[model samples]
Target chain A: MTSSKDTEHPLFQRIEGVRQRTGRVRDPIVTQAHGGGGKAMRDLIDDVICGALGMSAQQIQEDQARFSLAALAQYGDRLAFTTDAYVVSPLFFPGGDIGKLAVNGTINDLAVSGAIPLYLSCSLIIEEGLPMETLRAVLQSMGEAARAASVHFVTGDTKVVPRGAADQLFVTTTGIGVIPQGLEIAAHQLQPNDAILINGYLGDHGAAILVARGELQLETTIESDCAALHGLIAALHDAGITIRAMRDITRGGLSAVLNELAQASQVHIAVDGTKLPIRPEVQGFCEILGFDPIHLANEGKLALAVPSEQIEQALKVMHAHPLGQQAAHIATCRPTPAGLVTLDTGFGGERILEMLVGEQLPRIC
Target chain B: MRFVSEFRDPATGKKVLQQIEQQLRQLGHDASHPLKIMEVCGGHTHTIFKFGLEGMLPPSIELVHGPGCPVCVLPVGRLDDAIAIASQPDVIFTTFGDTLRVPGSQKSLLQCKAEGADIRTVYSPTDALSLARQHPQKKVVFFGIGFETTAPATALTLLQAREEAVSNFSVFCNHITIIPTLEAILADPSLRIDGFLGPGHVTMVIGLEPYTFVCDVHKKPFVISGFEPLDVLQSLVMLLEQFRQGRCFVENQYKRLVQPQGNRVAQQAMQTVFEAREHFEWRGLGSIPHSGLRLREAFSAFDAEKHFAIPAQQVADPKACQCGDVLKGAIKPWQCKVFGTACTPETPIGACMVSSEGACAAYYNYGRLSTSRKLEATR
Candidate 1:
């Protein structure tokens, strides 16, 4: 049997200790006092991620580790910074929770930007009176995930609000990394003839969380694809291929990101709908739930804009990394009215991609 | 998946789009006088908007959204009824999320909830039964809403409630029928509808026969369509062809799901559960005779109205709101003075702006920007 844990990223080791602070089980829900600075924050951090994942005291205290951030540097520069917030509902989901999501999300953002994640600062707002155990479990997961990624626990801030003032627990994370020398990535770097590549299937992460929450009934079990991607980034950078802009497909999913990139670069991206690597289960869930996969969220996934010639080299490197094993070339760039993403659908008609508005699956991270 | 995937197929979609475009051009329509068709189903409106269907169709073919959303068409009196039941200290009200935002005579159910009333938005009707079982001390009233498509679930729920002998469970049934509303729309002079894109799911329940009322009375072509891009494009083409030939008839293109008589088992369940009320007031259409359903006398114990002393009074819509005209397909949402200003989705003044399936809501979400874009592209 293949254990899924073996493919863990190196950044995980660095951030394990900091995550140990929030995992504690007290009452059923989170409390605003947990977010308050000082002992309260410490209690929350210990109760949630730290308590849930069960980190050692030594790992919790030292909070220092190194990751490969050199490859992501642009124009001889070395630092890359990224940040994101989690506002998912039913805080605890099937495969993961906001705690795991926060760490993985921040790391993924930095990874895709060609940076090797090194450290993170998490800020949390807890509704007053939230149970100690839920906070502990969240912290535990954060520590486990941080250890898996080998990212260091640097610093964090916490705040607490009155009951009902906060939605259980809300986490904001800022991740910093050192980009490797000579690699400059920007959306404008996407050329008309570049190929569009995806790390894996679309909509898995979104649908998994949705199904786990029972928002939409499906026959299969789908779990959130929340994981740190810095390892895969390292592998790709070593493979020595020119990569343009890369982005983690999160809220608004592939459609939102593609449209944003197209608009920014003044290029048209025509993705063959059939070429999309969506799981049958995800597709079924989307159809029954009346949602579009292109607009669904994916945590441990990204799209790469690279010259057509470098596609093979990128694929070889990506395949060696567990996170990028299922990666596929989904589409190619074309010269059209800039700022347009068109799908030549499976049925042979074209539809212009629009940014998804409102939450597709509420409470789905 | 069967109904959804087939319609989304690119090849099928292209065929339908090509056929619709060819038919539109063959009609030699004058660009000066564009063809306007109003889809009467809220579900249809949602599908149209979600896929940006308006952007796909030719400029000459303009889809004017209708007030087909049940939540959008729920009169203020119905909300008043729900609120009165929920506000009762002994009662816990349950409804779909859309209905919670519908303004009652005084305030919405959400406001009532904020004021300490027990109100919950349930994902399915089955959950209400669990609520009834859990809260045996309090009255549980499920705010039963939706057109024919959702009626079966409500019917089944009522039957289950009785079989389980759940005394605390009762239903505030606000279920409406489709045919009478269509008849009312035909009689209205304000709506100059050339044709209608019939509702697919409701037709799946009531079948294609009832829509004959639309064809015979209104002298307009009625096409039952599935909720897919291809299904919509095909229906549009069929309606265009009917108009060009000066023919009016009820046609069904959603053959896979909808039948002439619909599912007999579901209909039998409904027949056993409900009977028509003499007159029911619709939010935008006013009181249409024999248009609403009440729980049958056999199930009187399960009816909240029979057990509770809730007041039922006619409530007037806001004077500045033209949702009535919009629901009747008589006027466009933009024609209403308060449409974009006072009656936007954020602060919706009428039912049409609240429901996800509401015609106005659909336009606000998918059509507005696309329409503006089309105008700019043409210019």
Candidate 2:
């Protein structure tokens, strides 16, 4: 072990040597040699992953990260763990890339369950012939997103396959979080007369991806609403608002989340179409294509059910944050004979909103 | 959204609704014996159900959904041909999005696609032509189906392919005209329709001149109406006024997009590429003479039917479906025995329950609850 005061340790010198050797390849492209589990693989990881993540020599050499029991016991008594895989086409989009989506998506899975996200593990599967610069950029974005969410990438793995074995890139992120001692939130805790609220506008992520594919040939300035919601969620907790249930609106959009909640609690949910916070451009796109915006996907939006009296305080706290500017009260829960969802149209009629039978837009995430 | 929003204003719709009510009252029409007006366009049926226009109007004015939806009227045999073509290894089959789910005798295009078929959804026929240009080694077949509103675009696409010398592109033409279908509905002895709201987009292609027969022979008022809440309401008012004065005439209420002379260039393109078929099979209406179009002899090289051996035999509709009675306005959608029981949007047993614009689907999705409530009150 090197002393804490020693600035010129052999480990630091070896890391510096690996960095210098990687700098020699001016126009670097990944090849079979880099994935052979030999010196070439070490150099690629040292130059791209370690360099972008700014990992210490000891942390990089270790096989796994060990967390202390005392440190975890400070937050709560239970641990929340989740894992998600992201395979979005057109690796780069208007507001984010696959790396940021992987990070935020994992974090949101834990945060919506009333857990404070603490650690993440990132794994990458790269196709041979991808540029080294592209790998570096994605790693840098992941590091930046982790930093913004106050989480750490304690462990990771990388593998490269031959060309045509996979797409350009695919990422899988697993997250660990701790639920506070007093918080008990779940989808089944929803009660009748509870208020349903959303964080912001819907369908931005789905619409942005559709335009980014260049297949629709539509011109719009809509950007993906890919964001981490821990800050907004923590604020609501700090304000002493009692939340019964919460869910992130992701792949199946607001409709899927509400349906799941309604079935779980055995309550009926009725949402007003006029109250849904949808941008005009997104609505216009759906109108032209004969799609329903309710069935479209969203990334940063969340659906929360709380007591009717606390809705005002929840709205006030959410509006104070940057991510929740378009927060709205969308629906109310009722105790009907059957668990179903009804949408009161902006016109004076009502209809039942059901889960989509088939894929409305394929490869949306 | 400028033109769209103005036509859906609630205030404008209410005023027109009041005028329609007054005309009905002056003509002595009551709820016990209602006036049935058939809207001959699927687009109009969608607007009516989507906006809840049925509940807003008086019970005396009943809007009967007609057989104007091109997707709803497509026969089972034609869909079977599409599935067979799409299943071929070297062929790239393309069609509109809605046609992918219409059931055939065996499977739909969507089901074939799941089994490793190269089926794609395109917004226009030109997209299929471009696919042909991109892949010269593969054959691209476009399933051209719709009313007259969509026939011209397919015709123009075929002409463009010929001009560019794109040999891999072919069209499976199933385009149908609206006039003969309307004539078939009028000639049915079981139908008791009082007036007709003509299709708007079809009128934009072939103008109001073709609709004079509805008034001349059947002595029924026909109004070429737009597909909007206010436009439908205003057209109803005009039809009621005509009934009150005992005047049978064809009128125009969608002047914003449609003109008296129609689009001549589109008509010329359609005429150059297509000719009337001797007889065509409709899903609910049986076989009608001169109701469908086929590629002309000069354009046979670009016809998919000529290049491929398709099973062109007629397959009857499902046994328990009353789609014929529903299309001809002889019965309400709920009156059908299989309606909400054996037929639904998720598991459609009939063509009328497959498309969103179809009468059965629109009612099942939006109007079923209100209709059941009315049924309960009467019982």
Candidate 3:
């Protein structure tokens, strides 16, 4: 249990004072009565959801969250909205869980758009048999993560389904943020000779998830690289380096992200294979299972295209951040032969990458 | 990763390239038609294309991707049998993840799985065996498919099943051998391959003695290489030096793991539980005699083929698909009539387009770089 620094904000502290008189769900496990809109549901919501998030601020009694237009306007000129769902198997994994992923993943969706993520709305669909302890732990994690990232879980919903209806728990988080004035990062802005930079090691989350499934019977120390990225992006913006375009490497991994960027920007990207910062254990896992690290998922890692002259400054800012300690300049963007991505193997050959067609099945041959 | 990383040195690879180029110059070979070499293992083909090894080498050298991928060569009829068996009630069909998407005559195992069949992908045969132990009332069948390197695992698993008296555990053994298939390829008069990068894992199982015929009878150079980049380059140097001196024989460059006699314990396990079938049908090539293996009479009780009746129909490859030519080095994958057109990986009309290790799939995935017509293939 870690303390959340952002919870010390005066606005949330006021809610904390009011929340001290709330009710509790005495049941050890969730049941149908929790979804019946009765006293049971109110206690579950008040004690579990609002209690863990640190600030519900009257949103539980209301249908929608209220925000100050001027306060939001002060942060930026435009509003960035994004949504994602997490139905990951086993809900809990090393370094993070569905709760942490729900917070960080949605925050990243806004941050990568050059926005300062301000608030998130969470909805949880918990299966009937889920232990009350599990829900509390997950909600607690969501609160800690959001609080630590200086974002608020201003509104939320919780529903309990029949045991067979869901796989333990499902979390969906929607985030909105503000894009500061004069910040115009986009894929189409990517130009020839632009350098591609990454925050840290690639594919840890994907490898960690695959190994956590216990299908391959492999032993590894790899953990999911799940963390909030809005702060890291803020550091980059503070340095005043032009970020041509930025994308968090999540599902379909970096190759898929680069392919989309290349197509959108109409530029060819040449990735130096040696420059990729993949951990040896992750690489070995991919080797044994016949998976490509470039096509594997990451939660905290991001790829950004920046101007050639701004490369060193951008990297210096990234290196100073706690999350971007292993930041690397990996590839160079060039006018193509558009919509093509290639990896220079460092063995004197260039291997072209296509979007991974489907699930990266392990090869036996 | 110790032994593995040591063999991927780019510096050593460059030095080997110099010697190989020098040796080729001395041998008087040029890029007019090119000196063709066949690496007769899908694992080797994967390495060659993955590292862009074929493109990095001298332009005069061409690597003929052989019919070594078991998933690629699995006949449509056998796949149909597997699907029919898997679709049965109270039966759990297990296979390597690589074989899940391979197209059968009608549908693939993955499609069948999607249609509510219990087809599970396992990393090893033992995992399937565990499933059988866990579900005693249900039939658990491991779809055992590979060449010599993979057959031993299936063999050992079957032996363990017998030892444990696990009645529900069985193997759909689609295991194949290397020598007879090589013999069949060599017998083809149309192929004019100059040398061979021998299948390292297969050679490690059958041992080097079995490949002496390729030198004595066929008079073609053979070099068994490791899967790593540097080992491949070093093996090419060995093969080229032999070609420079007009020598033809089997040489082992993967001495770290591959021995002259191979793993005796694994060979012993294989000999105990299995015997070669008289003839086995290949997808590209027709029937090759004594090429595939099946459970021995003593272990027939643990054989899935014996346990369940299947639609053992001989389904033909599509009329336009020329996978045979690609496997035999007669033409490049792109040269096929339906290659990147009617026979793409998404809707593969040929068996070769099914597996990543297959030359067609590898080419379609890794080699299709250009937006329009492909670059002249270095493979």
Candidate 4:
């Protein structure tokens, strides 16, 4: 290889001319040798990660992922970047695993910013005793999910810690995307009379994870709604729905996202408790454990604030999309009672829906 | 889901609200002439705020939040005892999830857990027994805290542990009785409560006749209410009807669950496993005699207090906290000195600010806007 001092930067040149070092990992399970920073590490990186990603082994040998800036700039005027960590217990859940969750979660973060996600970086902190086959399965899941979302994993890292240093595995993903020119979206941009809309039911992921933990014996079939939403967001952008702001309802659930928007815009958000989209199984689970579905978490769900005029069109487009079949207009923002969000109980009464203070631990009462 | 959803029907809820209004008008009361009703269970308090029941009513009828929340009423001294048991290295301190945030004198159970304590939040006491079975070497102690509604589960769990000879399982019994606490509230002269909204879950265990002391002796109207929005509204009408007829006795609005004699099997289990303490110190209401339960001598082997040394010191509520006044219905939660300004859910100074079922938390989280609206109206 030519030294950079006399050669063109890789990002500025064609990557096709680079040479690859073919290797394969032989061990049945991950061990300390995989993290030795030597040939074994190289083998694991090349054979496992690169093979699953369908990329040349030399692509990960470099210290950095180099993509042509001129080519990336053609898609949009601005770049959006975001990162997320997945440490969900039991790593594998009903519908998704840590790998799939990591990819979708990061993509959703960028999608909410009105960006078309393109490339991602993955880092896996694995416990020494995890089976190689399990790692292979997870990597395969990451590859499949990324392919489905039309995003590429250009760079990655794998660290094997001593046993007991961490749980079985942890995945952190950083995504980069481009925002089309003139497309602006933000929580603060929300205004009065904006119709609050959400895609699908709330709290499926949280309920699914809770049941998967196998602590609460009462059971019904419920699965996590983990999915990539960049395509759904793109459809709205394409349909000219005038999307003002959007957020994937994650950790603290739908109420947390709405509270953030209300606080930023200094507006009152009114929602009908009855109109909220919740699956019967989720409702039954919440009923048994004294949990409010509104406070429960979701992975694939998104809450968007659209201008009142485009409410019908936004719903129509979202309903047509595969990921947003249950899209609903749930709320409307008003100017008064600033920085507050309220729920109409449909009992001729109204109450404030505050941000959750701490972990929504199950209550004994 | 069937029974639960039916109780929440808005059409039926609207009819209940109309009937409540009509009964209030027949009693010749409006916003100016208020009838103060105290719902004496944390579950009822939760139901009220969860459905915004307060805003549906005329301002003249005030619902006073009582000290029925077991977590809110759990004295900090007892929480310190619980933390002490939890901090032991080999002890797996199991408790209901809601009690994790209750502030003890030294630190909360959650804080201890973060600092390497083996704390687990179990859905039921039997889950603790399962833990004891799984980890035979570790000591499993269930921090039992609730009203009669949750007491039976712990009682039954202890019995099963005994039969199975689960040597490592024990209970830090903090289960409380509702009768003595209700008696303490009724005796207080500072409060002027016109009626009572009874706790349905507790009544499901103890039944209707136990409330005779509440209705016949005190001549106060009592309605055993269900924990639903419309159930709450309908119960208010039933309570008001008792007032209009100038009759005072125990009424069962939640007839679907409560029997006059209650569940004999649960009562039998509790009677066998537990006995009243001489005096149990409440967080806000101090030293209500025979209000809390402890394991009986026969089941002393299953009691954690006997197995581990407990602090048992009486820790006072925070100086600025007016939870006692709020619990006694002498003042509204917002009228307290530290209500929203100093004591909040994020940094709670009192037990009332910790649990979702607690009145202050229920109001602060769900009805804080009404307080602002009232201030604006006054302005």
Question: What are the Cα lDDT values of the candidates?
Answer: 0.77, 0.87, 0.89, 0.89
Off by over 4 Å in 2: A1-40, A53-57, A60-65, A159-165, A361-365
Clash pairs (backbone) in predicted model 4: none
Ranking by DockQ: 4, 3, 2, 1
State how far residue B29 of model 2 sits from its true place (Å): 3.8
Candidate 4's docking class is medium
Write down the TM-score of model 4's second chain. Answer: 0.98
Q: List the residue pairs that clash in candidate 3.
A: none
What is the TM-score of chain A, computed separately for every candidate? 0.81, 0.92, 0.93, 0.93
**lDDT string, candidate 1, B225-313, tens digits:** 88777888888988998987889999998998888899887888899999999998988778898889999999999998888777888
Categorize the docking of model 2.
Answer: acceptable
Model 2, B1-379: lDDT tens digits are 7777788776777678778888888888888778999999998898888777786777777899999989999999999988877887799998888888889988888889999999988888988998999999999999999998899999999999989889999999999999999989998999999999989999999998999999999999999999778899888988988898889998999999899878899899999999999999999889999999999999999999998888886899999999988999888999999999989887888889988888998888767766765667657
Give the per-residue lDDT digits (tens) of candidate 1, residues A226-303.
878878877777778788988889888999889888988899888887788888778877766557788888988888
Model 4 misplaced stretches (Cα beyond 4 Å): A1-23, B375-379
lDDT score of residue B372 within candidate 2: 67
User: Which predicted model would earn the best DockQ?
Assistant: 4
Which scores better on DockQ, 1 or 2? 2
Residue B252 in model 3: shift from native, Å? 0.3
Best by TM-score: 4
Show the lowest summed lDDT stretch of 10 residues, model 4 chain A.
Answer: A12-21
Determine the iRMS, in angstroms, of model 3.
2.0
DockQ of every model listed?
0.13, 0.28, 0.48, 0.64
